[model samples]
Target: MTAPIVTRDEPVAGTPMLDARLVVDRGAFRLDLALRISAGEVVALLGPNGAGKTTALRTLAGLTPLHDGYVTLDGQDLDRPDLSRWTATERRPIGVVFQDYLLFPHLTALDNVAFGPRRHGLDRQRARAVASDWLGRMGLAEHARRKPRQLSGGQAQRVALARALAVNPALLLLDEPLAALDARTRLDTRAQLQRHLAAHPGATLLVTHDPLDALVLADRLVIVEQGRVVQEGDAATITAQPRTDYVARLVGLNLHRGRADGHTVRVNADFSLTSGDRHDGEVFVAYPPSAVALYPRRPDGSPRNVWPATITGIQRHGDNLRVQLGGPIDVVADITPAAAAHLHLGAGQPLWAAVKATETRVYPAAPGGSHPE
Candidate 1:
């Protein structure tokens, strides 16, 4: 989608593109984070709200100062609080596309893209030339003369991205770059963004809570919660083995931590589950909600993990009904709409939930980590 956006010579891969640690103490909230990104790589900081995903982006861009730790990018020190070394946002070889796009209301898209280069010492004529090429590359040449108010959300977003890349930044930071668009626009823009990012040889950090964005745009995922990293890994690995309830829910899996002895894992004093895989000591178990089956009465045959649960909520999930069950274990169950009707599913209804052992996956939990809530 953005295959032609490389009109200006993009920077070649730089060694040690990003090596940083950031610490921000805000009296009530503190963030201590360390991260690294090589040239031509995209790393996503994924987490729930107030998890400090955007704060990390700001730290790397030098919009927020580090209380401790340092930010070294492409062999340059951007932040080293102890040494009183911190580069201002504009001075750093970084570009940030904020959640809101933040385009100038009165400026034409062309001028908006040219603003950065103009400020960075390029003459008006040359700046406009660069902007013109970028707008054309982004498939926005026709909209180049439109003011921010006249342009569509996706068009404005393209202009914002062009402006950021005009200076050939060594580090690219994006904060929910697609949040303002509609679902359709988001899908299209996301694909366009992926192409642009792939063309960028610099290190890219994307801050978002959307799992799809991280899965599609980033080469690696770093999940943060309460201002600390809970897990960091590739999409497939992290998706298969989430470390926290938040991560599990984000990835659409039911996960529980417990003590494992053989194929059985005790989730709590009141509940236990058997897994196809065996483990010892602390362990984690996960299963897809679709694997859960609801019965009006206790089943009479077949090996099953059965428990009594009260329906706390019910909603449509695509073609299935999502049943929120609360009992010894809190978990979501997906059932065909016809099955839900056959069982007369309703909030507060009593039902038996079962999952086959073969559907459950077991893995070792962090050695000393506490169980996730």
Candidate 2:
């Protein structure tokens, strides 16, 4: 087995900033995910719990041993199973920010940020100077002397980020970066983190379960389910046509399986829908929660597709109400608070739901098929 040498700055067509064909087997659980990230691009790995999002990150960071396949960063072969070559975590040009914001309790903010550079063999003075600059960039210059316990959650996160970036790695990995912050602090920290990530020249992979985080922070999204990539696309594309129930629930949409003939799609034998676009064969039909109109009994107006649905659950979504309905086809509807009050909407309430043909979209499912959740 010989190590494959990868030359940087050698232009290759369609070459990504970081390319990894990772396969890790751990007893019953196996992760086989292929990922690519362009330079300066941020790709968010979104999935539910136990979906292997963290496992993928760890494999890329060399924290988890690869059972097969290879990892290439900036064209360098970090790991290659065929060659029996593997780079140690410290040797890999990557930075990682854990969920808990792992900061030394005894070290100050500056010292925490300096630790990486110092370990990389930089002089103490130079490392501190680099750390100071990062702290300044994160707007934590005033708290450089503060310890982990002394700093707020948001502040500590920033310090952790600065520490990771101070080493100037080729790839940055963040695992649930905002999971530790409070609601108010999370919002503020998200914006701040976005700004810093925007300026980073290296590729970044953010692992988060939050849809808002993926939509706001990522240029593209990669949704994994049960150790497989279920969907990968831009926010608009993924949001408009979620490939799984988890994604549909995240984006607040009713997703259904149907067979399409032109613009009409039939679902559940009894229910058929007219979509905005024309398509044939097996398809997916999706409509946003807001597109559904609920009626107390039955409306007098023209209704193409109206189904008698029973409210299965109700919750507040932003300024509106998210009502989950069950019938021939399960659906979620978003109605205004006033409408909800007027209709006396609650769990187990009977209602009729209507959606405009133009509001619905139908497209062919992916080649491998839709995600089963």
Candidate 3:
């Protein structure tokens, strides 16, 4: 059996890379998020648009001022509102790659990457030498002399990453680094990026909306909603138990809040679910969409959880079809194409959805939930 995943509030072992409470206020919106990353660890920051993801990144990069709290990197105070201390962006030991791979259009790939080392006080010849080595490591040595416009999208992204890494920064910030590539290019680049990220010894923070990127590239995930941290944990723990609607959808799980009594959980006034686990008080019930089985009519079986549902929508999910059902309790179920054909699935089609008690997982709703550090 797998042990339960612990919360992020406790201190992380080993040397700390970036540790700070980011507090930035913009009119009605306020971003109050505490973030910590250990050396050689990559943490992914995921959230919907307007969830303060960009604000948090900007604050860390020194592009935006903090309304409160402080920014500490490598045991140095970069920003502290109480002490009235601020570090200029260039003076900070940090590197950032923007969404567009903001490389200088006129500069060659080699020169573009060398720019960072030059800014950090490296001489021209030495900076170019370091840049050439990095470009070789990224498998772009052949495109060293090509201009940004001449390079492909994936090539440009690699050059941008090499530039950021050439500075040997204490903290590396990536803001939607792979958002601009096409599907096929993104796949190839994602693998390359993962290798480079693993090699980086500095603390890394990746801000992205793609779940696949977070799962593959990050050591831990921090999910934010409404300018606050909602959940933070490893990929396995997060996928197994989601605490909020946004997180549930992010991980492709059906989640519900309810009061648990032994094996049964009362989700609402009209609906209740039975789980294999026994827990008391307010709890969260979660299961994968694949766990839900749909039948054209009520089957003659002792299924512990069954409900009458109407198909609200249907969409292709990979090789299978994802059916959205709405009734007493809204849920999503994944069925093979053959099963869909057998059930004649369509929007507004009525059916029965059932889940075995053994498939459900329950956990506390609040005490184990995310809290501000």
Candidate 4:
């Protein structure tokens, strides 16, 4: 489903500080996206690889030219092909933090953070003072003398963020800001990033593939696929009602779309499942992997949603086993280790998968209309 894009002429109150509809064309691929971020808000751009997330970010940062459409920040047009208006990257009041941190290898942390303010016309002493304050805020004051090579990954990330913020940018762009950190460091840095983002007065755009980062750091989410927006909303709303398989998987739900007749949804010619919620017309049925129960034998319980399937794969998911099954329907089921042992779960083993009708959530499939191919 495509999310609605608020137009510039729309009489909406509290217009977003960052408003843009980016359209860039390559030989075989095109990027068309509408994005808006209010002041003091963090919006996460999430999508699969090659979904044009980077293209959109680059276009907004003036690193890439817009094929059409416009990029407007705080009522000022940054890029407008139709109006022949464009702002150079260095001239725009924007800061960018690359995935690699992109710190100057030879410069000390203090000088690295001081670079942006200096480029923005600050004197050497004034820029260093601002950079020092930012480093202190990031809890990296003591590491100011260390070069990029001497700093830890998390410390380098903080230094990069300090540099980005030192210029007092009007818009901040972060591309996979924490993707390079280890799991433990990522967790700590994510929390720190959330605090810093909350304190920033300008709009911020975060691009990342990790759903956890998006869920934890963003005020809203914009999910794209194949160069078009598929969904956009608050984390809770998107998590509970995913519109596509990609989004469903991101939220850890097994989703299937089909014709809904009362409480039953016909996923395909050979498969139909019952749901607790009732809806007519096209609908999507979703249930978590944990909601599925697996059995070596056909379950002889009430008229529950049950199907015979064969194990396609199995992997450890935390303390549980995640089993992928293939039959009339392909699905993933989470079972305890004890249950896995009891069922002798293995690849190619036949099993029965059952889910309670009440566990399934049903919603209209085309609530927001279709998205681009």
lDDT of each: 0.88, 0.87, 0.90, 0.90
Score every model by TM-score: 0.94, 0.91, 0.93, 0.94
Question: Could you give the C-alpha RMSD of every candidate to the true structure, in order shown?
Answer: 3.9, 3.5, 6.5, 5.3
Q: Clashing residue pairs in candidate 3, if any?
A: none
Q: For model 1, how does the per-residue alpha-carbon lDDT over 137-254 read when each residue is reduced to its tens digit?
A: 8999998889999988898888999989887778899999999999999999999999999998788999999999999999999888988888888999889998999999999999
lDDT of 3 by residue, 123-214 (tens): 79998999999999999999999999999999999999999998887789999999999999999999999999999878899999898999
Higher-lDDT candidate of 2 and 4: 4
The superposed Cα distance between candidate 1 and the true structure at residue 344, in angstroms, equals 1.4
State each candidate's clash count.
Answer: 0, 0, 0, 0
lDDT tens per residue, model 4, 1-373: 1111112243245988899999999978988989989988999999999999999999999999999999998788999999999998987778899999999999999999999887777778988898999999999999999999999999999999999988777789999999999999999999999999999888899999999999999999999998999989899989998888899999989999889999989999999999888789988899999999998899897748999999999989999998999999888999999998899877898888999999999988776543523
Q: Compute the lDDT of residue 193 as modeled in candidate 2.
A: 94
Q: RMSD (Cα, Å) of candidate 3? A: 6.5
Measured with C-alpha atoms, the lDDT of residue 373 in candidate 4 is: 37
* Candidate 2 local distance difference test against the native: 0.87
Instruction: Choose 1 or 2, whichever is better by TM-score.
Output: 1
Query: Candidate 4: RMSD over Cα atoms?
Result: 5.3
What stretches of model 3 exceed 4 Å from their correct place? 1-15, 367-369
